[model samples]
Structures are given as structure tokens and as C-alpha cells.
Target: MFKSGFVSIVGRPNVGKSTLMNYIMGEKLSIVSNKPQTTRNNIQTIKTTDDYQMVFVDTPGIHKPKHKLGEYMVNSAKDSTKDVDLILFLTNPDGELGKGDSFILESLKGKQCPIFLVLNKVDEFTQDKVAETLSKYSKAFEFDEIIPISAIKGKNVDTLLKLMVDKLPEGPKYYPDDMITDVQERFVVSEIVREKALRCLRDEVPHGIAVDIIRMKKNEKGIYHIEADIICEKDSHKGIIIGKNGAVLKKIGETSRYELERFLRTKVMLKLWVKVRKEWRDNNNLLKELGYKNVK
Candidate 1:
């Protein structure tokens, strides 16, 4: 019988959730960074084969909320578990599992679906350490399975995919084989710009920032003319984003345009402006306007 299902990836921040999704899709359907809470939305990426289709939902890493945006992120992550066929609770094997992992596990108490404790970044750990991690989590929770994987190195990812497919029940294909993601191109573009900013800036600047696409249009020559504003929480952060003589902003634009062009498969004329929003993360209305709605 044909099999298909939704798989929700849930975990604490920076657990390689996005990396695992990208590796499965074989494309950059979700953005990744060393920063925690890098993914703010529940991104649905589709992987199809001749036999079955698996739709993977990449959620924001769960964390204690310090602002309205953070609250929305955590809710989005939790709500994604509502009807999924499987839950891939990712953990970084290089680090010790602690209260955060426990918190996520507690939240999944009533979930009826099979839960897999995926030990990611296993390439960084020794075999004994991997065995110990398996034993530790096995004792903590009665997971359906404990799978060791390296999201970066592509180790055991295919095995995990096969196991997930086996767990799926017979169902109709929800999306076409050629369709990779449900997110709009505009959203992807905004994320690309935000990823660039996150990689370029340091410290509080990246966390306190959001990218808004003000305009995106194609000219007569078929090249995309795009304009976006980088929103920051403070005026001082604005100056840092622009840098000395507009160098930093220029770099962000150059790198973003390069990637945007590759994604769009055409030339792009990109312009960026930095604006101060004065702690927009704490503002509920502003957070909603930025598309960070409370999922529940």
C-alpha cells in the first residue's frame, strides 16, 4: 500500500532540526545558523519517492519565552505536534541533555504518535558516548526508537527516513512530487536575507533583527528588483548594521543578492534599508505584523 504522513521535528534550540530537514529534502527549504531559534515558522518540506511521500515540518526550537515573538515560536513548535504521524525529537549528542530536553519531553506526554529520540551530531561523539546517550534517554522516556544520526555528515539519515516511512500508514499524496515546500517565495527570500544578516552580524544584533520585504517585482528585462528593510530593536544596532561608510549593509546586500539570484534563476537588483523598531519583539501587534502569530 502507498504510505504518506507528516513528521514534526521538535527539540530545544540549536539541535540541528533545520539541518536534518535540509538534508532530507536535498535543498535549502529551511535556513540554518549557529544561533538558537533560527527557524521562526513551521516549514513544511515534501520528500517524494516512487513508493511514498513524507512531509517534514521543521519547527522553531523550543525555548523559554522572553518576548511575544519567542512565545509565538514555542507555540508554533508545540502545535506542530498536534496531528503528526511521528515526532523526531532531535538532541545534540556532543552536549549533555538537560532540563530543556526534559521540558520538551514533558510537553509530548499526551501525544499519541510514535516519538523518535534522534541523537544528532553523533559524528562528534564516540561510540561509547553514543551508547550512553541512547541508554540515558531510553531510561528517561519510552521512545518508539532511538536513532543516532549526523545531520551534517549525512550519516544514518537515509536509515531514519526508511524507518519513518515504515511507520506511516496508507494515505493519499497531499502534494505533488515536484513540489518541495509550502512556503511562499517571498517568505523564502526574506529568510535568505535574514540568514545573511545572522551570519554577518555578531552578538545581540542578529537576535534583535528581522528582515521585511518591502517590494519585490520583476522588471521588463526579467530581472527581479527587490527592496527590503532590516528591522532592529535599537538605534545603536542600526548603526552597527550599516557599519562604517555603509560597508556592512553593502556586504549583506551583495551576499543576499548572490544567493537570491541563484534561487530565482535570474538576475536580481537588491536594495536594503535598516530601520529601528525599538524592541519589536516584545510588541504583540508588531510581532503579529511580522508574521509571528501565536500558533495556538
Candidate 2:
């Protein structure tokens, strides 16, 4: 019989949820960084075969809300847990489980589906430590299964997948075989630009930034031309992005262009512009316009 279902990957920030999803999907369907809250929205990555199709929902990290954006992210993560067939709760092996992890676990205590406790970054843990960590988490909740994995090193990831598939109920495929993710091409392009911006900028700058793809087209010569605007909240921020002699913006453009070309598998001509949106985060209308609404 075939098996298929939605599996939500929920965890504390920087615990490697996105990295695991990208590894499972065999593609970079979501962006990754050393920064926390890099993933702000729910991303669905589909892994399809002839018999089974597992739709994995990669969610924003669960954390205390510091702003409207943070609230949205936390809510997004929680929403995924309520309806999934299984919840893969990730924890960092190198760090102790703190209030944040406890908060998430308490929230999930009432969830209907089974909880799969995944200890990520196992490459950083010793065999004895891995066993001890697993025992500690097992005491927190009666998890359906506990697997130690290193999402970056591909360690025990296959075993986790096999166990997950084994528990899924019989069902038909939900998406096509070649389909990897549900996000649109425009959203992908915008996120690509945002990812580059996040990599280039530091501290609060990445947090204040959002990217919108204004135009994308292809010429007869088979070159893809794209233009996007990077929205920032302050003129000082804009100045930093633009850099002296416009060097910083140039670097962002060049780096983003290379990635876009590689993703699209074609030549890419990208133009980037930065604009000040003036405290757009606090402006509900602006936030909604930028697609940040939906938090209650």
C-alpha cells in the first residue's frame, strides 16, 4: 500500500529545521544561515515517489515574540503542528534544552499527532552524550520515536526518513514526482534576493530587510532579466546597503545573480535597488502589503 501525509518540522530557532528539510528534499527549497529566525514563513517541500508522497512543512522557529514579525513566525510554527500527521521536533545536541524548548514541548503536549524527537547536530555530540541526550528528551515526553541526526552531515537522516515513512498511513501521492516545493517562482526569486541580502548584511540590517521582485522576463537570446527592490526601514540602512561607490549593492547583485543563474539554469541579468520604507514593520497596512499579515 502507498503512504503519504504532512510532516511538520517544528523546533527552536537555529536548530536546523530548514537544513533538514533541504536535505530531505534534495534541494535548497528554503534558505539557511547561522542566524536565528532565518525562516519566517511556512515552506512545503514535497518528496514524491511512485507509492508515497511526503509533504514536509518547514516552519519558522518557535520563540517568544519580540515584534509583530516574531509573533507571526511563532504562530506560523505552531499552526503547522495542529494538523500534521507527525511533528518532528528538533533540538540542538550542542546546547542544553532551555525554556524555549520547554515552551514548544508544552505546546505540543496536547497535539493529536505523534511527536518524533530529532536531535540535530549529532556530529557535534559524542556517543555517550548522544545516548544521554536521547534519554533526557525521552523523559520530557513520550515521543513516538527519537532519532539523532546531523542534517548537515547526512548522518542517520535516512534512518529517520525510513522510520517516518513507516508510520505514515496509506494514501495516494499528493504531488507530481518532479515537484519539489509548493512556493511559486516569483516567491523563490524574491527569497533568493532576500537570502543574498541576509548573507551580505549583518545584525539588525537583515531583520529590517525585505525583497520584492518587480520584474522578470526572458530575452530572445535566452537571457533572463530580472529587477528587484530591497526594502529597508531607514536611509542609513539604505546607505549601508548601497555602500561607498555603490560597491555593496554591486556585490549583493553579483552574488544573487550567480545563485539565480544556478537555480534557473540560465544566464541571469539582475538589477537591484534599495528603498526606505520608514518603519514599515510597525505599519500594519505596509506589513500586510508586504505579505506579513495573518498573525492574530
Candidate 3:
């Protein structure tokens, strides 16, 4: 008997949702950065085995919205809780019993599927702190299982995976074995550029920027030639993205090309340009164009 299901990993921004998924899938399907809100969409990563399959949905972090894009992200996260076998509420010790955690827990209340309170980053805290968090959340909500893990260190992740597989009912393999992700190659390439920008740009500038892939074509030599524009909200931010004498922009392109090469398994000749898109977050049309569509 084979079991298959979708598991939604939900949490506050920067709580290691994408990190945990990347660790479990052993593939960097979602981009990771020090910045919060780095993942803007629900990325489904398939982990298939002879006994079971887990389609892990790495949802955007749940946060208070300041713009249309933010609203769409939060809604997308909420929608992921539906029609899934389990939910992993990933959190760290510092956020234990905090208002942000409380808000997420409240929204998760009465979910039909079993909810797992996954306490991440346990390596950063003491055993007592982990116990304290577990005790508090156990009273707050009756979770199906409570597990602590260090996603970066690969601690107890195997146990988490086993438990998740056990919770799933017998079902069919929804995707082919060779496929690792649900998103298209173009979307993944665009996210690679955005990830580099998020890592290199200033804190404020990263959030104001979006990446648009203008063209991507594969030549006969199996080399990918791609063109893209990095959209920012202000002239000053554009300068920051471009950096001194285009040094920062150059770095972003080189790193992005390296990542694309690894992901696509081909040489990537990437070209980048920075453009201004003032308040694009609030513009619904631009938001949709940037892939933040309404969840329905």
C-alpha cells in the first residue's frame, strides 16, 4: 500500500519554512535568504519513494499585509491549509508563545487535517527551552504530533519525514518520479535572480524589487541564454541594486548564473538590467504579472 499526500509548511516570515522543505526534498526548489518574505508563492516539491510520496507545499509566510502583494501571499498561505494531509507549523524558540505565533495558531484552528507543531532551530536553544515551547503550544492547541528539528543541521528530520508519511492515507502518485517541482523552468530561473538580489541588496531595497524574465532560449550547444530586468520602486534603490560601477549588479548576475547552471545542468549566459517600477506592489496588474495572483 502506498501513501501520498500534500504537506503544507506554514509559519511566520523567516521561520525556516523554505529551508525545511529544501532539506527534506534535498533540492533547493524554493529560494532561501536572510530576508523575510523571500518565498512569494506556494511551491510544491515532490519526494517520491516506493512506499510513499509527499508533495510538500512551501507556502509564503503569514504576515500582516502592507500592500496587494502582501495580501496575496498571506491568503496563499491560508489557502494551502485546505485539501492537505498535514500541516507543519514551523517556529523557533524566540517566537514561542508570541503574538505572531498566536495569530498563526489561531488561523490554523479547526483545520480538518492533522497539524504538526514543528519546532525548528532547536540547535540554537537549550533542551529546557524546547520543552517549554512544547508545553505551551500543547495547551494552546491539540496538535497531532510535536517534533523538534534543526533543519540546517539535519537533526530528527528523518523522523519527521517518517511521521508525515505515516499520517498520509493510501493514494496515488500525483506526479512522475523524475519531476522534482511543480513550477516551470522559467519561474525557477526568475526566482534565482530574485534570490541573488535579496542576498546582495540592502534590507529595504530587497523588498522593493521584483525580477522579470524577458527572454530565455537554449542554443544548440545546450547553453541557456537569458535576459531579465530587476524592477525596483525608487531611483535610489535602483542605484543600490546597480551598486558602485555596476559591481553589485555584476555579482548578482554571476551568482544567479551559477545557480541556474546547477539547477538547469547547463551553462547559463545571463544578462540583467535594473528598471524602476514605482509602488508595483500596490498595482494589481503588475503584482499578477510578477506572479502574485489571487488565491481561488
After the best TM-score superposition of candidate 1, give how far the Cα of residue 180 lies from its true spot, in angstroms.
1.3
Using lDDT as the yardstick, the better of models 2 and 3 is: 3
TM-score of 2: 0.95
Residue-by-residue lDDT tens digits, candidate 1, 1-296 = 88999999999989899999999888987999998889999999998888999999999999998887888888989989999999999997654668989899989987899999999999888988888778878888989988999999999998998889889989999998899999999999999999999988887788899998999999999999999999999889999999999999999999999999999999999999999999898887777777776632
The TM-score between candidate 3 and the true structure equals 0.97
Top lDDT hit: 3
**On residues 1-296, what C-alpha lDDT tens digit does candidate 3 reach at each position?**
99999999999999899999999988888999989999999998999999988999999999898888888888988889998999999998653698888999999988899999899999899988999988888999999999999999989999999899889999999999988898999999999999999999888898788999999999999999999999999999999999999999999999999999999999989999999989998998888888777722
- Measured against the true structure, the TM-scores of the candidates, in listed sequence, are 0.97, 0.95, 0.97
How large is the C-alpha RMSD of every model relative to the true structure? 1.3, 1.6, 1.2
**True lDDT of residue 2, candidate 2:** 90
Which run of 10 residues does model 2 get worst, by summed lDDT? 287-296
lDDT of candidate 1?
0.91
Q: Is candidate 1 or candidate 2 better by lDDT?
A: 1
In Å, residue 227's CA in model 1 sits off its true spot by 0.3
